[model samples]
Target: MPYRKYSELAELVEMMSMAVTSGRFMNKLDDGTYYNLQDSYETFPVKKFENAKKSYAQGIEEDEELLFLFDITLFGSATDGMIITNKKIYFKDFLEDPECIDYVEIDKIIDRKISDEECEMTLCHKGKATKIKIPRFQFFDHHFIQFIAGYAEILQQNNHLLAQGKAVLKDGVDNITDIIFDAFWNGKKVEKIR
Candidate 1:
């Protein structure tokens, strides 16, 4: 049986290709008006995040780590934002307060094309649904987001297959010749296909 070790959440964030800037520079630009995920590394602005954290996250569980933070902001105003962590995810919007869910609790990741320029990702848990507007950063970034939406499922399947002595993850991983992201990326074919 094969197993992969996860040392930290940043590894997954990198897998998603999320553009996170250390707060040292971006903060001077935003002038620290708002906070981004804002970790110890100052991934974004952190000075204001403490307040937001108290209002929203209130600190995650001991073993949990924040993996991603996305907010739909226009001219610096945010209607909502989402935070993905090692164990679960949290969402907060104008309609409601912050909500959290475990990774395994996610039942499906539904993606829909809204138009030539827009698309949305929906996470369905049990019977309820939460929608996230995929940020258009580049030509193919959305696919990574789509994959991140199913991180739990992907890891589970890969580990399960490895436990069964299957090397699908290895084969795909070998195709990449990398130590990480073998299970998540499978191979470069995904990039060529898209």
Candidate 2:
């Protein structure tokens, strides 16, 4: 069988869409505040959050649509945002747009701290370190946090196996993909194999 590059991306989009639509997403806005997933969109005002508002207005422009998004703010100002598409994750700075990171580019999850009030995480990707702070109830309390890290590990494995051989890659990747899909779609427990 020939390697289908987009197959994994397509599968991921499906899995992530389930996570979003099922209300299993953890949404954190600016100001270190938390909202129930049900109230996620309420944080965005049309004039202030221009990009995010545009995304909402356009409505599913791609098959690889946005699964989850975070308005990354500094000192009560929305300067950047995190957008999770079906394929990759992006840290979009309003001043300059840089390339996003794929699963394979994510080196490791450096640190994660969850307190009663908020959660903070550090990730090293592509030799760059990034810090993310959000309310504990938004991310740490739900499975979406697990999905983000888990998907990266799985994607790294999938790419490695694909580089090995088509036959070997299919079996290894499908197994992991099935497990992850079931966890997100069927409410199955994900084995933290990595």
Candidate 3:
């Protein structure tokens, strides 16, 4: 399966970093095109492998998953003020994992406007509301560096899902001709059933 070239991943990280730092949502416009506010700038660049490795070592020693995730999130926030946010898919395994426990600590950083009497807790985009505990912090630390590390790991593991065709770039365009032509020709030659 094809993976995103390192350059492409770098570009994506840069764009996300910029969006978070500027307090702008990276939403698609009604025209089906993507754009960001011009005034926005990246909080920080993603750390290189050497730096990540060093931090990972320290993180493992801390035996704190939230700290680890926080480290990852803050990777991008080092240059600018912390302004990162995290959104997990919310799965059983994720909740059970110690690392995930740390990840949930992100809620502490969000700034919710609701008061304790008005607050309601709901499951991942579903289920009935229930009374729940709220943490002291309202938002996750918007650390750009840590976010870079965590997101990069996710992308690396799931790169196969992004494959559209063989790895080839011609004249600055991703080449998908081989896969497309092969599929078209082979599709025509398949045997028909009565």
Per-candidate TM-score against the hidden true structure: 0.53, 0.54, 0.21
Identify the candidate with maximal lDDT.
2
Question: lDDT by residue for model 2 over 118-177, one digit each (tens)?
Answer: 566677887798765554443333344555676786667666756766434345655666
**Candidate 3's C-alpha lDDT?**
0.26
Per-candidate local distance difference test: 0.48, 0.51, 0.26
Clashing pairs in 1: none
The worst-scoring run of ten residues by lDDT in candidate 3 lies at: 63-72
Q: TM-score for model 2?
A: 0.54
Predictions: Cα RMSD each:
8.4, 8.1, 16.0
Residue 80 in model 3: lDDT:
15
| Better candidate by lDDT, 1 or 3 | 1
TM-score of 1: 0.53
Evaluated against the true structure, the overall lDDT of model 2 is 0.51
lDDT of 3 by residue, 66-168 (tens): 1111221223321111111122211111122211122222222222234432222322112222122221122211222234333434333233333543323
How many residue pairs of model 1 clash at the backbone?
0
lDDT of 1 by residue, 116-146 (tens): 4444667788789877553443332354455
Model 1: CA > 4 A from native = 1-15, 18-44, 73-79, 114-119, 139-141, 158-194
